[model samples]
Target: MSSKRRVASGAVLAALAVAQGVLAAPGAAAEPDTAEAAPARIHEIQGTTRLSPLEGDRVRVDAVVTATRTFGSSRGFWIQDPRPDDDPRTSEGLFVFTGRTTPALTQGDVVTVEGTVAEYYPGDPATTAAQSTTELVKAHWTVTARGARVPEALALGPGTVPDALTASPGGSIEHAPLRPDEYALDFWEAHEGELVSVIDARLVSRSTDYNELYVTTKPQQNPSARGGTVYLGYDRPNTGILKIESLIPFSQRPFPKADTGDTLTGVTSGPVEYDSYGGYTLMASVLGEVKGNGLEREVTRAQLRGELAVATYNVENLSAVDGEEKFAALAEGVVSNLASPDILTLEEIQDDNGPKGAGDGVTSADETLRRFTEAIEAAGGPRYEWRQIDPQDGADGGQPGGNIRMGFLFNPERVRFVDREGVDATTPVAVERDRRGARLSVSPGRIDPQHPAWEDSRKPLVGEFVFKGRTVFVVANHFASKGGDQPVHGRFQPPARTSEQQRVQQATVVRDFVDDLLAVDRRANVVVAGDLNDFPFSPTLRELTRGGTLRSLMDTLPESERYSYVYEGNSQVLDHVLVSRGPRRVSYDVVHINAEFADQASDHDPQIVRFVPR
Candidate 1:
């Protein structure tokens, strides 16, 4: 079952318990006759890997405090049995919620907690928040003894850890534990809310804003040069990496700024909990210092001979207001990393004023392109000319006043732009037969601007170019963004991708235009390249290549090396370059300068392909 259904089920159990008069109001005194009731062992209260059999029963547990969260939404402390049971399937630890009131308890203090056994979901129960934690709520506590010995933490590493992060098909944790020794989800479920330790773990990714570290006990699989593991395909499971969630409510400024491959040693103790963002996170009580590994930056690819390079880059909402620093970095990426491509299709190029709410109809990107081109020349690269047509005021959807659109940059020394007259933002350009066989009516024009699919989205820009006495038709596209899509690890099992419907329609429009060109001349040199915003395996891309008129170059890449963007822990592809059958592809590569790094100039990694004209 999905996590949402399990939470709903727990809500029902809570209602039943309240109706039976088993649960009392907060701070309410227990039944007067129960003064002689014997305290229950922590393991008996936490019966199995799933729900507690004693849930809703008023029980008293005697144990020693292991960790405490004095503040934050989950103001509570963890108590574990000093002498644990022989069975490894049942945990001996539990979290006692004291609400906003602080309890006078310290680590290693022996205490007896009397409360109603209730399962609680951290945030709102109805939302995407996953599994409910078995917690003791609406209770009272008293110190039985002070400064007692704390329970020894269970050590976790390679052989003891499960191979796969999840066992379910869609990557959701199952409601109940399956084989605890086989899957990570099952093993974590068995030890829910228990104190555990991971020693000498390697940092696989940078710490998040919430001061959480993603570490692995073993070496990362498909390790990239920058220290992150490159997710080759969905065929294999994760490499037993886990997140260390911080309970420190104050500033995490003292936390180290370590890169990938760094080592973190010492005893890192925490109680495991299921979090919405990170699947199973350890709310740490004691975390170790990060030691850097002296990792260096990745270099650029070498330029190939007798090949014309074309690149696609999404300069995340570039405009004049961003100043020179961002532009200079982008120029270096384009020239050094991309090997000074002859034709560069740029996406997310904002208006002159940028995101500064200066209304639409601004229509001037001269200063923006000039600054970028100047930066390229300053970086010891060629001075390139740019071409674009501004969109109608507020017609394109992006950051409100930014008016972001797609455009092109080309080196005049290598290629020449073929310009035609009478084209505007609303004008829909078409292919026509001329003395030069098949050609665009107006070069650098919008494709099917009147189609409903192009509403509030970027329109495909078609441009005609001549390189080495051969005409090449290029289409620059920036499809609708993937907004409002459900997260991969959300409550919904096999989460819905609602944004794909609009992209399917957009793909059809672009494919029809390509078909019109192919009808005029069967073997026309056509190259479509840009930030497609859809994976090569998605249904939207399937529609584009349905008739086999255009083929995605991504198929030529090895399965392990076909990613241009990283989201969560998976490396995926959202940018593409498709070519007709006429051209000969020399090489293609997606540069890994950004995306995996914490200090990234842009969220996407640029892609370049070298091909020879027919």
Candidate 2:
């Protein structure tokens, strides 16, 4: 949610206590400066490239403080030069990181300070890669004057930012000179650390728990059906989206609560700064009043009597320790919104003591299922009997100790689960044929669990169920996440999806499973569903739907309505329900329950496909 304005702890420090008069900033202000020079302008310090040419050299600048954070992890002040420069390539504003000193400064306070030019990255390079923020660290300060003339903030609008989201696709643009007129990243880079404004701001996504929200200056740039940005392709990533991190103290004004389609009906002024979350962000000091758009969560119509309603939901690391309120809200979403699916495949089911149980050698999730099913029954929904294969404790790569795995919950009255011989976590589930047609070697088993693609990831849980005397082969999946992927607005122009190939490998594994089932019986009633954490247009999806064996329900909907998850400001698909050609008539929906709301039971929206198996 944050660009992580607060810095790392292993910084150089020759200063005093971290919190003397203000809160300790993210970087514990460690670097000390001994070099001093004549007054230098801000633009000269900010070169055309991402890294400043003057970095590591001590220089002074006379500028007015545009904003101040005397408290919190980013306790420092932002200053911009009043004099205008002809070159649009260099920025006139700068951020002074107050390491240990709580410099008493106010907005519009003129100051001349000497400091070392340093490029700071919020995260460790050994684990995560993040963009660097140019800062004037380790300083000697002098108050030049108070209440000086501050430059008018640059107005950012649809016309100002480039329509092109990037200049290079999957290539580094760090050395590229500023091309402000041609690219969005370049435009923001030219105005880095400078005050900017957005009028009639629309909050595209829900305000995060950290009080951070994404706003768009261009609302018409590939707008989604639900009044949000649409991420159509790797090239067209909705360049209008810009993140906002409030600098205003929470005590002064709590960040306004807002969801998708809500508008901040005035000017939102803030300094443009770079962070790793989603690149350039509006470090908003002035916020507008939020106007409600009356956007509500969507509901999918319940399946007909002849239809077998199957759904997939990621319960976001659900465990027995979760609060009753959370369980009840989730149950309500299923009952009222989803109208209670017949067979639900749940992902991220943790153990009895939540994630901690894995470390404590307690891996059973019987209690977690008990609480969830009871909550569903309490909410006036059907009593769903559950099935799951517990993974090796602490083997899955989710939370440190959370051994999350995929599970199933089926309504006994509506459908019957076929319980055959099962295999452990490392064993595989193979397809076999008998006189009664294709059948699983073991019912409710995992597909190729020992494959390298399943290493440190959840294996695909394949379940066989009978609805109206016909067998339905459903494979529920929670593939490798998109964690290691670079930010869309990152230094790599198109941004690298290092986590993508793993998903592709996982998708290929699942695709082969579906193909094998269809090979035995061409008209196999197979459905592949779950949090396959990638976009609908991604290679992962293409692989899953390859060879015409399985068809993605995502292709059935209009482009505007094909989203199941919202990222930053873009409404995109990260969850999907795919089926074989066996079902002639199929109705599918990416239900809107949690992603668009601020108070969500889960971060993901549960999706369902209704069809009658032939």
Candidate 3:
């Protein structure tokens, strides 16, 4: 709505916009559907559903330019009808993608445009599917009038969105008639491309490095104690959570950089758009400043000298060559926040050269662990000795050369690692019993590395540790990531969890291994921990803790506090610690140090469990 507003779309939208049209002649890209080809108004083009009824049809329309991107990869302008459309179901605005070419007009400039209506699905095919934004691609326009008043932004508040997440159950809601009063998806669809604003909204999550953040209009929604809309269930995606994408470039007015529980002071206005990252987004023309709520990082109580404290952390692809600051901060979290757990299971420890940065086909993480352990010692923590079996070069799934794998770090002063030879990446750890009862055949060994469940994924690292003269079997895991799962708010209701099958397989392998330990000794001190990468409510967890051989530490916490990760705005658990029947008394914590903060060393929050072995 402002002439000075600049468009700063995300990399996903920017790339998709370039895919809309590259200007190989003005109308060269249009492949009009045989259904129709005629002049249409904004409402007619947008229709009354989630998708445009006239999509894929070439049409002509006249409207005023509301916003424009003169630079960047997504060079496009937003156009909207000044006149009223009485139907509350249809939007009055549309995006005109000009590809690499910048628009020649400013805000309030009326224009007549002809183009093919298209639906632009952001991100690549691999990204979780979500609602798409309707666009006018391969366009040509001419100025009809200048200095016309810009359309006023529609005010959105808590009352604007329906408490319901969607109207259709897991089916394509594209044909469903608009029920803006009953469903949030429909309400957002009704206002698609229309300039909208939310005043003084509460930030639900921390602002990303891109200066983007999610805010909630509903204060009473399923909120976390630390001021976040907890994604309690797949059906309970908070309707009030709105993603604010900065339209004003950082050079002009930077996006508010704040943590969760912060507030967006003043008006935040923008056009409603959809993307893969955050389903419904408000591309802001008017940016809001952040008022800090002072949500601080949490510090767990240090374990007693006699207690065995084990922690699991996914350092987020840490090989991490240029991560001096990151390494220091992570070490500080281990020392100050996590209280320097005796045994730490680190996931995503990349190879020596960082993510895809390695040459000579190196896969070992000697340098990576060396730097991380040194940092921990410098941060007033004990020298942590580490052990891990290196995976075959380029065998793991993460960034190609990253060779990400799970490793263990233990304080020799607090605990002693039981050494066993013949442990390699492919060698599976086995439970062997002799005169001294059950013990590991190979310490620092892998569990079923050659199993199909571990194909292209990090193998579970199994180790033996002795604390207070008691042997403890620790299985550290970094299961397959949730990369391919369809979003909960995707077009398909109850979006399919395609990535879950792999995690389930990995869980079965880990569960069976735990069962093997329990089989050899009925009361073995065993701890299973690491980045499970699945929620507590998932089938993967159900299968992993089957037979009750290992009980998840998350089950020990209150329902609201069972989270170690915050995704979008949902406070949920991905990392977990589970103990066997041998630990008579246990205390577990999902240390809230990183996941909710804007300044984070890792995307995941490390979780620790302390117990006295039998």
Candidate 4:
């Protein structure tokens, strides 16, 4: 809590000197001007004694860290003292010893810590009182420290747990997989509703969005299983599950709320769960005293003023080919043909090698998207950032040159590519024509399967965009074929007929994902659009549009202009734009653009949709 807890000493200077000799110029003399300067200010202590001299009451200590050592704690041994004393006797019972310091500390490192001077207390190991300190006990530790180091990591002192239970055998409980009895309370007054820290209590029950926070005075020793009190914490926003770790009362001491400073209150229900659909997170929860910040309010173009514009275009197989001008032409066509929407939803982008393949013939997912981005930027459009899952070359029925994929392109000026959600649907196997169609195995050269799920499947691309002063959700999907074979029904129809089954399944997943999102808040503005590979009369499309009043941009066209890809000799509208609600119907249109391009980059025509929200 004090600014003085950031000072460095001469030991740092000596260390830097030795470091320079080892890391800097070998034969040439080092220049003084090039040397780092010492900080003008020194770290100092800020102390305030509490009326109750308990173990976890944070104090202030302004001293230089001479050494760092890890010792056994109630949980297990971890990096403890940044600087340990040579005479353990003198250092013992100092009350105020350093716990964890971010940016780490080294020998002779100077730092000023403002935290509780913890003292060991006696207790039993069986009861909550014996297990650890109770919420009312005021034996919980509070810490806040700042220092200079290579890589900073938060540290916890012995006082992290109540002194009473910490000394008992099978001591302070490890808070991993949080126990039900170990709950936490966050104080947000200092941050004006921004949660500062928490007081760990016990959990009574759990729900989809919220949980009950209660104080535990004793531990429950299960003779049949590993023993410890149940703790509580969650990560989902909106639906509130208290994040115990996030609320650990480490820094922001002095209690953010004046009334809550020492008072131990209980909120019967609190936010606990956050459901993620597509790329958006829906946080749901119940609060005790504080009311909602209208977080459930829907974000739309009207709320975003005129800064947001909804644009969609179907880019036919934007795949890269080595030594072929078509690859460069394809990239150029995507940037040139499509209207630049603040957030552009693209369809039929090819992933030949991986997700984003090299246009130069090599199968590389990163290369394909990289070229597409470069082409967009080169075409006088805003910098284009995108998200896609690179599949292995020949995985599934991927494009020949690279892994042809579906994705979205956004102008960073309007929206920065924060992160993506969902898993990749692409496989990593080489081209192995097995009897059971094409079986996909993991490819060694493609993206390592060890990464997160989102990187594997290119099915759905999730991204965040800042518009109308609120975050808007964007999801791009390319459903499976509608006429594919349906082995599930024992119906040996054409590949096209069976394709509908996979399409329905994919749509169901999308619908369920969207339903989960709407459950958190009904007003969320979501757009599910792309070359569905299915027609309007199909059952899969009907299922997706059933509950939420889905609006199709293609419906606005004069039926003739709605088709995206022309098959056989028949011209039918396959591409579409589906919104949450069809407002005025007059406010949406599907522009037939690619039909006019003489080069006709790919077989599929790019469909454009413009929507004006009322």
Model 1 C-alpha lDDT per residue in residues 1-614, reported as the tens digit of each score: 10100111332223322322233222322232233334577777777545677777878776667788877656778887655666666677788887776655678656667787777765675664366677787667666555555656667776667766545445344344445666556677667777778998877765654566777755655654555555544345455667787665556536556556677778787888767666677788788778888765455565565577788888999998897889999998987877788899999998888878557468678888989999999987899999888888778788888888888899998889999998889999999998766899998899998899988899999999988887889899999988867544344445567788988999999999999998998788888888888988788889989889899988787666677776544556788999887678557777877765556678788888777877
Can you give the lDDT of residue 233 in candidate 2?
Answer: 82
lDDT, candidate 2, equals 0.81
Per-residue lDDT tens digits of candidate 2, residues 1-614? Answer: 00112111221121111222233222223565666565688888888877788888888776677887666766677888766477788888889998656667777666666788888777773344465677798875655455555667777777878888657744677778887878778778778888888888888898887777888889888787887887788757688898888888789898888888898788888888887876789998898888989888888898899999999998898999999998999899888888899999999998888866557877788999999999999999999999888888877778767788899999999999988875677778889998868988887898888888988899899989999999999899999898888887777656678898999999999999888888899988999999999988899999988888788898888888878778878888888999999985899988888998888999998999999998
* Weakest ten-residue segment in model 1 by summed lDDT: 1-10
> 285-388 in candidate 3: lDDT tens per residue?
77878899889899999998778899999999898485589999999999999999999999999988876554467887899999999999999999999999
Error of 1 at 598 (Å): 2.2
- Position 269, candidate 2: lDDT: 87
Better of 1 and 3 by TM-score: 3
The superposed Cα distance between candidate 1 and the true structure at residue 239, in angstroms, equals 5.5
Ranking of all candidate structures by their TM-score, best first: 2, 3, 1, 4
Residue pairs with backbone overlap in model 3? 170-493
Clashes of each: 0, 7, 1, 86
| Root-mean-square deviation per candidate | 7.2, 6.4, 6.4, 26.6
What RMSD does model 3 have? 6.4
Candidate 2 residue spans exceeding 4 A from truth: 1-32, 124-129, 169-171
lDDT of each: 0.74, 0.81, 0.81, 0.36
lDDT of 4 by residue, 1-614 (tens): 10011222444434433322232222111111222222211111101111112334333333333222222122100112223233211111121222232223332333333333222222322321211111111111211222423111111111222211111123222222221112121111001111112223222111111221212222231110111121111121111122221121224322121110011233322111111111111111112232211111111222133544555556556554333454555455445544456676666666544334334444445665677777666766667777665544544243444455556677767655544233444332122233422211321112223323223233554444555444445557666543323211010111125456666766676666556445544545556767677777677778778775466666655533445543211235566677664222224444433332223445555544444322
